[model samples]
Target: MSKLVLSELTLSHFRSHKRATVALDGRPIAIFGPNGAGKTNLLEAVSLLSPGRGMRRAGADDLTRRPEALGWKITAILGSLHQTHELETWAEAGNPRQLRIDGKAAPQVALGRIARILWLVPSMDRLWIEGAEGRRRFLDRATLSFEPTHADAVLSYEKAMRERNRLLKDMVRDPHWYSAIEAQMAEAGATIQRNRQDTIVQLMAAQNAAPTAFPTANLTLTSPDPIPDDLQMALADNRGRDMAAGRTLIGPHRADLDAVFAEKGTLARDCSTGEQKALLISLILANGRALARDFGAPPILLLDEVAAHLDATRRAALYDEIDALGAQAFMSGTGPELFSELDDRAQYIEVTETDRESVVMQRTSL
Candidate 1:
């Protein structure tokens, strides 16, 4: 089976880099640079290859090169088999972002179908302990990787919920209006919930089958609302509370995924910081393994500052698992020492900033 590889990268008017291009070899890429050296920005550019916001979750306007001076563009050569394909993403001088594959315009969501991507950022370090929104997003990102259509269900569910909220606030008490919106919500919500359950099942199976130092987690969906097996009945039942609260409080939107360290019987949030990080790493590896087996090609992995939180042993283990899966992983760090163990097996890149301009150079061993 052929694998996906990024053969070349070019960026202009994006973040701290004014103009830069680097030819890449087919190996895990290790990028080292100081803070604010635009290390994470490179990862963010890679993330745009998939759907939704990049790693930083910045808006299209924010991504426009600072000083409001110029537009932004990112182009990359993606190789699979013996053929190469081009993907370019750009935002106008002061307009919304757009994407094109092979010079043909396409929807942003279309990217996920062509290239699945999964990532872990430094901000997600306390995901389990924080609000459910972030954890839900994390789960959805994983879900989207496995099932790109999940994006449609999420969009539909959110749209319907928004309308219902507006109706509640406006006191548009028409049962007919409620009927239509609730129907849409129920259909989309059920599908959304099912997708998440399926993704968790796949991850669980993968984790159970894989061997790694990363701690394992047991995941479950928790919500006060009973996700009805029957959509119509669910809508009718929750209508009273919905009207009173002026919000659709029961459905996929309310569901939260709970994770616990299975062996230790520890709540993910209650676990030590290191344990929590380990659990996240375990899940990410499990995700990669699952995708590799299901899709024949593992999804591209983005680990922003992944090495900073782990000890030497765990960091090495992470690399080992990634190698075994044959996935293309882009990991960022502050120096070569952080990736010393992966020296021979992975490609290396050095990032630096001088005179407020960023440059990326590929490193090779003699």
Candidate 2:
């Protein structure tokens, strides 16, 4: 099978690392450090190699190093499908982020074609109990992993919805004004919905086909109101209600992802905290396995502080699964002992903060 890996990574004036570079050999990376040691920052840099804001969702200004607040930059050597590509993403003085492939300027969406990234972060532990937006974002990320064009569809839908919301806010009553924008929204929203549905199908099939230590989650897409079969007409018909609400009321934007523990038949939100985490891990693993089967390579996984959340046996199982999949997963934790299960199967990196500067030290080999 072909492999996708970041063979080399360099961070300049980004977060706590003024300048840091790491060369990799496609093994799962085990990063451990004390609190505030900037371990997550490294994962954030890897996330930037893909589309959208990094995992922190911080604005350009927020990613710049403090004191100087200079712009931040991340450059990577991406190994995908047996080919190598150089990727560079940076922001200058709080300007919009820029992307380059092989030293030529490129759009952010282009990155998705070359690199597929999937992540499980600490903040996502409460995904089941949180508002629908978080769940929607999570679902969208998984969709984007399977279909890179999903990003373009999401951006287009959001743009059209923003314009429609503005018109509604202005109390525009003209049918022609709403017609074109609603058409755009309908087209993009349909694609978004279809992509999400397809992704859920893939995840379900993956979970059912593979036996894993993690609990299986039955996933479904739902919305507060019935989704119209004809979104354009729905948008036009609901303009009055939307105008009253001052927003686009019925679309994929309002969609929610509902999940249940397949064996227990209990809602994810009602499951114990550990069960919830396990379910999420199950989904993420299933997503990776499905992508591996479809794309010829599994994605680079950013599992931030995941080891600390699981007991030794489960942690070992997670490592074994990742290794068996031949995925280069970057996992972070607060101490080296958290990653003891990985032992010789993964590369170990120790991050430390000293004198207000972060240092990354390679502590183990492949």
Candidate 3:
């Protein structure tokens, strides 16, 4: 059995899915159907099993089923190692999302400790060509997987930065007003940087330790300018400039992730679309491998429309790698042929759309 798996998932009033239930075994899942059949919606629901706003970064209001707008609920049975966790999350219309674990109320970060989930969506195809925000978000996700408390540090940092920026925008010059906030930012920022650096190190080690069809990527964490040894002092020194710019600058917020296609020694930004996609898959797989050691089980992977981007050989190789790693990955494709390589190694879920609502027709094991 896969070390980590979602044995069951139920979605209600989420996106195009009015109500859908899927019972799964500990194997890679192949979700296939025509476009708009809600395959991705299933993966999105699994993504919410971890921290954050799911893979789409959607708000609670946006997740509510339209016309009804009664909000949504997702419940799952997660198998982590030998332990089974009953997880539930829901939102009431326009209200904030809430989480309950093992039938007890819990914070989102608490979920991080029980489940390590990673994802790759179609919109991320532009990760290299797009702005640094996407890359940073990806790096942070990786970091958060390794350190569940990374979310707390990130929240603290962002909260403090927002306050600092507000002061800057208001042109507040009082040193006292900035002292406490700067200290908070510096402390959290340092933790964030260290956690990210450790994640990159772990990912690289995982890649070199194993061989796969995917190419290696050399990663580096960079900043727009040199980050100072004394972050608090640096913030104080740059206050005048920050006030002029109406925002705080030169911290982890300005940091960017750089990647090179190691085999070709070319920047990821310069690689072909297909090559870029392979690199991403490699990293995600490596992240899973590393987590298997750290978390005592492999991570649950969410790969949306990923098979459509790879050739038959690579697709087979991807399945083989996932099997070798013992990860229960959820993958979506438009047709079953895209995942033919999975054969008896996977469980298939067929979905279809009728009258604007996505329905789970059946799940067949081949």
Candidate 4:
């Protein structure tokens, strides 16, 4: 299969790395360092190669190097499907982010057209135990991978909802003021709901067709209340109630993702910690497998501090699965021993902190 790889990457004034350049051959990268060594920062940089606010949901100014706060830039040699392109993204202090593809200025959504990125962060480990908001975001990311246009739908839905909420907060009683906004929300909400549902179906099929050490999860889309079949009318009907509550109540924004461990027939939230983590890994790997078949190549995976949670056997299984996929996964841990399972199948990077600044360098040997 063809591959999507970042053959080369450069970062300047980005979070912990003041300046660093890494050359690669598209192998999975094993990054090891002490806590706060800026290891996750490296993955966050890679996450920005796609659209969105990176993995941390940090703002542009938040990504700038401190003391200087002189904005940051990332440039990459991206290999997508059968084409190669120069992808660049950056932000100046006090300004929004910008992007360029192959030396031509482009919108952030343009990056989504050519690149597919999937990630698993430590913060996401508690996904099943946490509130529905986090699960929605996780499902949306998976959905976005399958359908890049998912981002536009999410943005449109959110923008329209904000306006509707504003009218509700002001106790607007006129239907004329809300008709247009509700129409936009209903249209975009339908797209969001459809894309998420389709993604869940794809993920379930991906899990069933594959044999892996990780546990499979039966995924479903849910909400606080029944999602209305006629959303526009529902919005109009709920306006009085929403006005009393001072917010838009029932819509895609209130949706949730529910999962069950197929083997044990137990809810994910009630499973043991290890089982929960394994289920997450299962879903992520399933997403990767599905994308490999659907998108022509596996996506670049950012796994932040993933080794810390798995046993030696499970760690080896994870590595083997990633290697078989031919995916360039960027995984991190607190020490090189955590990555012994990867051996020569992966490259190595070591990060350190000096004078409160992160220092990154490629290592020839672990």
| Cα-based TM-score, every candidate | 0.96, 0.98, 0.98, 0.98
How many times do residue backbones clash in model 3? 0
In order, the Cα lDDT scores of the candidates are 0.86, 0.92, 0.92, 0.93
lDDT tens string, model 1, 331-360? 999988999988789988889998788878
Winner on lDDT between 2 and 4 is 4
- Please give, for residues 122-230, the per-residue lDDT of candidate 3 as tens digits: 9888899899999999999999999999989999999999999999999999999999999999999999989999999999999999989999999999998878878
Best prediction by lDDT: 4
List model 2 lDDT by residue over 1-366, tens digit each: 999999899999899999999989999999988989899999999999988997888888889888888899999999999899999999999599999999999988888888889999999999999999999999999999999889899999999899999999999999999899999999999999999999999999999998799999999899999788899999998998999999988999999999999999999999999999999999999999999998889999999989756889999999999998899999999888888887788888899998888999987642
Mark the regions of model 3 whose C-alpha exceeds 4 Å error after superposition. none
Off by over 4 Å in 2: none
lDDT for position 73 in model 2? 94
lDDT of 1: 0.86
Task: Work out candidate 1's RMSD over C-alphas.
Answer: 1.5
**Considering only N, C-alpha and C atoms within 3 Å, which residue pairs clash in candidate 2?**
none
